[model samples]
Target: AQEVHCLAHGLAHCAMFCAISGNAPEHPVISTKSGHLFEQSVVEKYIESTGKCPVTGEPLEAADLLPVKVASTVKPRPLAATSIPGMLSLFQTEWDALMLETHSLKQQLETVRQELGHALYNHDAACRVIARLIKERDDARQALAEAQPSAAVAAAAVAAASAPPTSKGGEPAAKRAKAAAPAVESSAGELTPEIIASFEATSKTLSKGRKKRQPPADQTSAEALAAFGEVASEAVLPAGPVCVDVHASEPLAAAGGADGSVILFDCAKGAVGAKLAGHSKRVNAVRLHPSKPLALTCSQDKSARIWNTDGTQLHVLSHSGDVTGVTLHATGDYCVTSCSDKSWSLFDIDRGSCVLRVPDGSGGYTCAGFHPDGLILGTGVDSVVRIWDVKSQQNVASFEGHTGTVTCLAFSENGYYLATGSADTTVKMWDLRKLKNFHTIEPGAAVGGLAFDNSGLFLAVGSADTSVYDTKTWGTIKSFASGAAVSGVGFGRSAATLAATSADGILKLYGSSS
Candidate 1:
């Protein structure tokens, strides 16, 4: 069989090399081989001149014997002399279309990415809202569960009362009275069988000895006339309605005295009840006891005094320095006083002794108050409120948020909430159950004192700017121009009255529709 001859050039050389090397011939490998062969020849020539190969010992004159000739010049390919403007124009249009497609694809990709980001953000927000809703639902369920039993009992009582009355009511009442009569007689004194028998025998003998006597006609007539008179008087008499004369009186603005004196007013009648004048110096704070008519007053005289509404002194507490604030415990058994000497002390009014002292290590205590339970005391100083357990005399918590000194502290009636008024012109509500602040209300004024009403519906904030806040929503409920800085505010026993003591020695009262 004769083998066909194949020309050795570009394609033929590639096929021959592939068959010989058992691998496809690559352009990069062929170029690299050519460069290596040229470098080797140059290296061999240099080694021959130096009498030794630079890389290896070999004769160099054998490399010069190879024929070296000037290579013929390759002719350039001739350009096709044909005009095809339409084909070029078609290619340019295709390229432009391709570029537009690519740009549109990129924009779509960017749009998709933006939508994905927004979707992710919305998903996160939805998850947060769901979590909050779940928490609220759980809280409501718990409250409902706690109130269920009371609701059922009330329902049962209502149902029983609404039922029709029995017809033999008189007979039943007589029977019940007959059954209770012996029990009452036995309960009055121990009744022995012998004593009972002796009493029965004596009664029988007395009955036999005594003769029944009939009342005279004049006596019967007199008794009948008296009965008629009593019935007539009752018929003409108007039923006395229960009158709760709430003397809600505005405090008198009399001539101001040099010494601090706070006046107590009858909130229902709008009359000045008494003028409190125990403090020898400027009174900085005044608070009313929860149940007692006693008022606690702290003064620059370095003392706090307990005064009755009748202007009589009940007790006097001496501080190391001028007292700045005083608060009575909700139980009215104790009071807490803060002093400019950087110390605070808890006094037991019943025992007439200081039960606990918060040392002046952390600076002067500007304000102090007892928690609702009377088991905890809070002192304000240096822009922080430190809470201490009265029983343990241990500092339990410290609140840090105010930029200025804390001037006042108050606890809600439920004992689950605390409010602090600061010189920073803000009031912060602290949740005792969570041990964290819930919210802050800025009345745009220097908060001098804070108080929560008995119902926990309103907060009386005494400020130089004079603003009050609704406790439930923390909204500004009312405003009044207090002529001077309000040192303290208190709610009376009834939620209808509010009292504010100012630096101008005037105690103002405000009436609430609630």
Candidate 2:
């Protein structure tokens, strides 16, 4: 039987080789004309250029090549190295080659380290840029959201202003629109075009009416204001009453205590009337509705609630943080709340839902109030008092002279002057029309609250003691040493009654029967 062979790199296994390349062909082809075997691709290229086979110089083309299949199954033996000197020489050559290869690998490793350092530096730079871009994107989105109301508000305001001078039911178009249009239903205080439109309409009506508004006839006279003195003192709360408000319609006053209880003291009888309890933490502020039998109170429990005279909770409005302050709208159907979350919210009192929320961006609010006409809102953000137009949600103006946190503020009934009290022991009066601070009073103690009489003739200052100032002369009409911090102050409708609430849970009344 004839034996066939295999292809290997050693000469010991060299049996067949390509005639053209002098190497074993993985796929060999034989030339039919010359009978010479060659690698198919190499010889194919040669034929294309020369048109002849290499070994025999026979005329051949690609079509003349025939594939030859080897049938060898025998394994080739390795070349045997027998001499010791020959083996030593081979080992020495291999070691030298390995050393050269190791040096090459070490150089490649150093190059890789340098490349890695550059890659890390670039990656860090990219991260920083990405972070900055993300912050900018967030800021842009907020600005866009805040700016969305401008165009709509302007259009709505114009439409309202252009309405008929006459009334639909003996009332202005703006007031009618305010009654007809419903508040936007929202749990978050995001401004929408519809909300802006509604707000502007109300602003138009209120702003118009407020321009020519006059003091009511039954206000306290300047003579009666000067004859004020301490008339009564009573402990109306278990803990310090942090705030107080007199009921505009009844002979009662509500004091919110640090123990989360509201004391309903009958100012007429100089005695306790009722105790209302609901809040789980210290009450921050409280107010009785201007004309209704409802009491509104906000607490550190992060909520504000409305209650009827019988102590039934009417509505509970929740907030994102401890509600810092709450103010009733002129209509008594709505309320505004300031929060420690750096946001303030508007709520529909009857619906118990958040109508709008506005983020302050700089600092959390410490207090809140509304203009007497209800066209705008004033809130204390840190040491500054920012006035916002409710219609456009635009920051219309800011009072920025306070050196400490603005603790409380009140708008005069005539609506021209705004008095803000601060923790810096000073009270500043801002003339809204002039947009300037017209007066400043240093109370020698932290000013916690301020109130103006219905006629705007007297200013009630609540601090370490209670002081009454004549608005015209800016002179102290009367002063009472509370012996404790006065957290709140108020005047009766006719200025016949002056009340101050102390941190010691005492309600001090000062007035003259004559």
> Highest lDDT among the candidates is held by which one?
2
lDDT (0-100) at residue 436 of candidate 1? 59
Shift in Å, residue 443, candidate 1: 1.4
TM-score against native, each model = 0.49, 0.61
Q: For model 1, how does the per-residue alpha-carbon lDDT over 135-210 read when each residue is reduced to its tens digit?
A: 9998676555433322333343344345455466543421010110000011112324553354345434432332
lDDT of 2 by residue, 1-514 (tens): 0111222222224466899789888777777666677999999999999998888887889998877665556655334335677777778988999999999999999999999999999999999999999999986764453333233334444544454564558753220111111122233556567655655565456555644556666666767767777777988775474698876646677888898998788888888887788999889899888777788899999999999877889899988799989998776677899999887888887788888887766778899998766766888978888776775565555677888899999987656778999998999988666456889999999997798876678899999899989888899988889968999998877777888988888888888765
Q: After superposition, how far is residue 454 of candidate 2 from its true place, in Å?
A: 1.9
Residue 486 in model 2: shift from native, Å? 0.7
Q: Distance from true position, residue 501, model 1, in Å? A: 3.4
Residue 306 shift from truth in candidate 1, angstroms: 1.8
**C-alpha RMSD for every candidate:** 27.7, 23.7
TM-score of 1: 0.49
In angstroms, the error of model 2 at 152 is 19
